[model samples]
Target: MPCAPTLAHYWLAETLRLREALWGPLEDSGEVRRARAQGQGFGQKVLLRAQFLGQREKLDLLIARWTRGARLALLGMLAAAILAGAATAVGALGDGSRSVNVLLALTAMLGLNALAFLFWLLSFAVRSAGSGTWLGELWLWLTRKLARGPDAALAPRALVEVLSRNNALRWILGGISHGLWAAALLSMLLSLLAVLSARRYGFNWETTLLSADTFVSLTAFLGWLPSLLGFAIPPEAVVRASNGLQALPETAQALWSSWLIGCVATYGLLPRMLCLVLSLLMARRNLAAIGLDENLPGYAELRGRLAPPSEKAGIDGPDTPGFQAHFRPRAPAPHDQTQPLLAGIELAPDTPWPPAGLPAGVADLGIIDSRLERKNLLERFQRQPPGQLLMVCDAQQTPDRGTIALLAELAGLAGQAHIALHGQAGAGFSDARAAAWQERLAAAGFLPGQLHAGLAPALAWLAAGQPARPIAKDAHVQP
Candidate 1:
């Protein structure tokens, strides 16, 4: 039995629940529909619309839509196996040779199969975490192709990362590998039977280097395992009867054919059949392990959203009704009026460090670019965190998950956190880009629209010990 459908459905359900709890669901209302409609790619559409689905409902929808496609993929692989089987069977029925070289047949069938299996096992052993396998790459490509919607590309990276890490892909690919081998072997056996039916074939083994006794011992050793399972071991007389080019008598011939067929079924097909079953079992097991990593910066910070509702919930403008309620941050009272400090969060090397024009009493805490620097910054701040820390970054830089994670960590040490952004008016930085960064910052649990575009306001905001105002959407603020 294949486990893709079962595993994928389970994974989908888990993801749906986590996403809903963390990000909230998209209600099936005009607001979501309009947003989804306006979205440009499947990513955007999925994020917008999937917010509406209950855990079970999403699973049902996914299975109903993708199950047929999965079956079709399997069928296509089966068709390829049939072609390979026909080719192998044709090679088996060579005109002059009455039988295949038992060594050659073993090498071609079981040897090749064992080699491929070993490769997969080795890969499983040596592969790193968060790194994708070849099968996973293909699976991801297929997923993107199949799941393609106009807005799908706009889906959150966090969601994509979760989908990739799910064990369902591994299970599906494992099943496919086992199924491919089993189908090819079954078809090859059937083809061998068809050819053997049409001819009275004599079995003979020809070897230039080996003596007859060598083959007798080889045959006995090879048949030992199958013999334990009731498959007959050839008599020594029958094995030694393989005098080169002098064909074995009909009785010996029939026996050799039976031995060959038994080996193919037992050594070749049986192992693959067992593997296919095991893959399905493993697939089921993998399904149980497919849970979300809430520690990821994207999912980690969403915890605040799950907090109980409060009047402090910031309402979206009256025009957009059903938008997720955001909490409003009240300005800290201007009381503990100590001079603040400024630090850059991995600001670009070319950009000015410890940006000038702070109040005479203000201090330049330091720049934190590497993980070590962050650690040191934290330790030093543990003793004396800045009264109001100005966490600065370049507006020209993209706000990635790493940046958010770092900002979130740094925000924890500040008496009050005021985020500052510069370089908006510089070459390659646009107002739209700055706005996107603001949204990302907000999602990462930073003060919404608190990013500053100019050094003056950022410095002023830091000195004032209050949340900064939103960067102007229409014009870039000059530093």
Candidate 2:
């Protein structure tokens, strides 16, 4: 797996592609224009571009753009950190008193920040703010600069219902937030040290309502770890002397300063640094899990272009006129149905699993993709096959030769089969892809009545098993 920074850089690159994908199939190049002219859709064009750029080139491009965006954000953060350090320095030691109240000065400098960190921890646990992460506003600005509006909706489809749906993106932003906090805390600590060196500043502690004993207990608690690290811890005498009732002697001032430094190191700087490291490790793990989601509409649509199966003419009859199929999205068929085995073959990215339309006994074989999954499905077919295997597929995906080949193979394995086109139907149908699927199925010896929209219709048709043609011997295979 790549390191945290490397993964973060790639995330920016993926975001760039996803943003451009929102623009749909538009292209300025003559080659792209020609591809579009030849009935190649917007998605296939994007895949080709990705291929042309190559993986290494894509990484390089992402690094360049990621660095530019990082630099802008870093510069802004640096300004904020410097300003904060300067303000806190002046606030901490600017008093003309020979001895500064250690409690009062440190609290003034770190109290609000500690409170803010606590609130941050609360928000992290809840994770309710997906799109509004700590750096979300900055990320949004960078997005707008990279492209125009990531429009509210894409009609037939949308970009992961907006970028926030990308969990990987949110995790990356979390790591970035940890890094920013670390920078701010470390800067504040360094600035405080620098200010102290410039003048003879005395540090003391004084609280009005609290007695000397109260502070003694508190100091002992706060300094336990610091003391273990060999840092000096003030005794009860020092705590009593800093009760704001009396000015401490010169020697006591140095002891108070050492105690204050120890508290800041243990409570402030070290914690932030530790959190930052943990965040980076988590970010790396998440990045390593991200893969090109081929199930997405964008990638699904490119099936034909990416893996066009070998042309074995007549495998599916040539005369299919167009890609349109006899499929439309309809109300879910009524529920009184004998359960047919359900299997989804790369259904659309948005299609819900354990499909909504089926009956109770429906066994979902999952979306078929990898060789292992295919092997499992085949094994199940032999183990306990259904009357009819309802193979679900995304209509938006062009039923390319490779797709048809798989469908044909699966159909041969089951006793009986049908194809349920999930996404592309009715108003959203694509003529070219639909026609291709129809011709392929026809040649594969699969017929209508054998076909339906989803589990709902497939079950309904099976329950009503009407005046239909008897299946060919080849159509009903032995398990």
Candidate 3:
């Protein structure tokens, strides 16, 4: 039977739970708001939102709302099918030889295409309508109605903010896989039915019914021949061997019957496999988007229960009230409405991302010393915290210290600076100038929380009124 509604719902919920177990749910409220402010594109925003809410609630809301009266919709489909069949019959009755034949052939092809197009359009509209604010309300209502079972809370991704953000590539791949299996099996069965019908009509007179015996002995020997052969083999052996042999021919027949199945199975699997690969790629991309990878090593670093990078290097702000909330749509545009917060960024058509480069002495440890020559400039900024120094540097254009170099001057000013980097920028800049400075630093090889890592210790030393080591150059520092 076709999948029952309840079964489909459970399957969707289970799949979402699996995703959450592997990648965490999207961060819904603050992160999305920050992402929007930072000039993330619409697709990015949608994906971020999906990560936050997890796709289950989104899928449920979408299917429940849009697929309402699905039974009624099926009735419409059946009616269309009946009308199609009648049209074919009427045309055939009128002139089966020429005009009716052409008309029937065209209708068979074009009418099916039209029907498919209509169904797809309708489904897309329904899914779209179930998105944004409407979905949020529906989700809230469902959450209240369905008691909080242990399985209800899926682990969320820190990046995603809504169901729309779930990897579309993965979904498409899975659908293609299923479609292939179904179509292949259906065609095989249909071919078998046609073959059986042809067989029943009787084979060509020249073909034998069964036996190829050339015995010249009398009828008495023929009657004994059947019993002798039957007794020679066990009943089960004959049946099993015959069944296996039959299956081989049937399979061969099915394979030979249609090249369409072969082409589809081969070509269709490509998109499905591609989708699977994209799902993994997207997971890594989404993680990078939120600055999580900076705190860890590679993308694989997020797997275990290791302590998170650091308070400064993480995505969350100090506010706990914003946790666990899902995304909602922006309000309708108003007369004389203000431009979007990120208007100056010019995110689309042309992205304004800055080059990924660090300012000198942003951290005063051996890390920078390992990358550039510091000269004697480290001593001048050791007297004050980085916070005080940067605030002062923000105002002044020059300082008469050891060197007039940009690195030395800035290093002196930001000795003990503490800042929160939220929002997503369409461009890149110095770590401090980027959306999440500390996270970006970690990602770029400055281990902010690793005690053995020299960068954090140097920044700490600078904060504690101590001089920084001289800078050096290293190939590892570049992204």
Candidate 4:
């Protein structure tokens, strides 16, 4: 059975499905049929199809690009937020020259933040709040911009569609927005504490139309929560006396400073921190529930192809013919012997290339896929034949006339050649396919000891510098 699907597998399969919808259908060289036969479920079949079609490498590239772009976008946003926070803190204190306007400072620090927080709260009631906050949108825009290419938008589009279909987009983006805001607020708090510790600044409130009692009441109301948290609250006298430009006593200044810090912490930082945690939890829960949306436009068509209905069958004609070994052994060709070479012929796209564990000096002529590549290899073999040639064939594919002929020709060029059937012995039709290859190669004059079930024996043969023992003339080959 195929392995369980992961988030990346879902993303890759969904992206490919969407691409098929946008572009025309992808060419299938029996991959879907093989996947249906080998895989145990819809998810596994989809993943198998992608692997057989060699889409994993493309998916890896796309994922790498997205990760790099996201990191850069995050760094950029963080730098901007830090700068903005520092600037806000500096602007609130106004160079520390005159008595700081406590009311104005409070408004400057939190008025916009409060408005933004209220908007975020209201987003829960809105149906189309998946657009998220401005910061989240900006991050997305920057990420896409940094990863610009022909296929750049495909990944992000697929991710958004997947998250949005599961109603996880808002929470995910909300978490990002809240986290960034929290970072900014923390930076502001730190900057405020640093500047206040270094400077001797007084705090006062002035109003042209409002009375001192109004400032006192407003200050009391705002400081109430902070006071409960051990932050100092200014007395009515301090609030009354600091209504002008006159410098206040040290006790009044200390109280005003504590109040300012407390209010910023209570109102600005705490709310963002709480929302950040909430968004993260909600996002995680929703994301954990996400799965492949098989009802999407392209996925509906795959159900029939990947899991077709069963049908009753009856024999209505004569039995088909059985296998017959048409052995036409001919004298092997002679050629100049050189280094040993290992090569793969028409292997599946997703099969690992230049496979590992090769002995020291065997030259790996990578997988021969196209006609030009085959012709080139044949010409190179003609010019300088290998002393021992190990040709790897995909056991999953049937041995056709062309493949048999090519194997024969390559065997004729090498001083001694061995054919290795490459695949798992227990996979669907693998044993039958391997037996077919054995019969075909034997018919082509390859000795029984020269046929290997897989690459390990071939490598062992190469490493031994020859066959382990002499083969009897009438010996039978085991697949």
Considering lDDT, which of the candidate structures 2 and 4 is the better prediction for this target? 4
The 10 consecutive residues of candidate 1 with the worst lDDT sum are 319-328
Model 3 ranges with Cα > 4 A deviation = 1-59, 69-75, 95-307, 310-479
TM-score of each: 0.51, 0.52, 0.20, 0.66
Using lDDT as the measure, which candidate wins? 4
Residues 25-83 of candidate 3 have per-residue lDDT tens digits of 52332333332433244433333333333341464444343234333443443444445
Candidate 2, 140-161: lDDT as tens digits? 4554454322331221012223
- Candidate 4 per-residue lDDT, tens place, 1-479, comes to 23656656666676677666665565442356457657888767877776654342265578667978898888889888888887899899988788788889889988888887887777778877455476787787777777776767878877777788677778777778887888888888999999999998877887899998898899899999999999999999888999775657899999999999999999999989998898889888887787776677777777766776852233212222211112222343455555678889889898887876888888889998777787678777666767788888887788865576567667765777777767764556545566677677776567777777667767888777667343333433223
After superposing all C-alphas onto the true structure, candidate 4 shows an RMSD in angstroms of 14.3
Per-residue lDDT for 210 in model 1?
A: 82
Q: What CA root-mean-square deviation does each model show from the true structure?
A: 18.4, 20.1, 24.2, 14.3
Where does the lowest 10-residue lDDT sum fall in candidate 2? 323-332
Candidate 1, position 352, lDDT? 73
Better of 3 and 4 by lDDT: 4
**Which regions of candidate 1 fall more than 4 Å away from where they truly are?**
1-67, 95-99, 128-168, 315-479
The runs of at least 3 residues in candidate 4 whose Cα sits more than 4 Å from the true structure, single-residue gaps closed, are 1-4, 51-57, 310-479
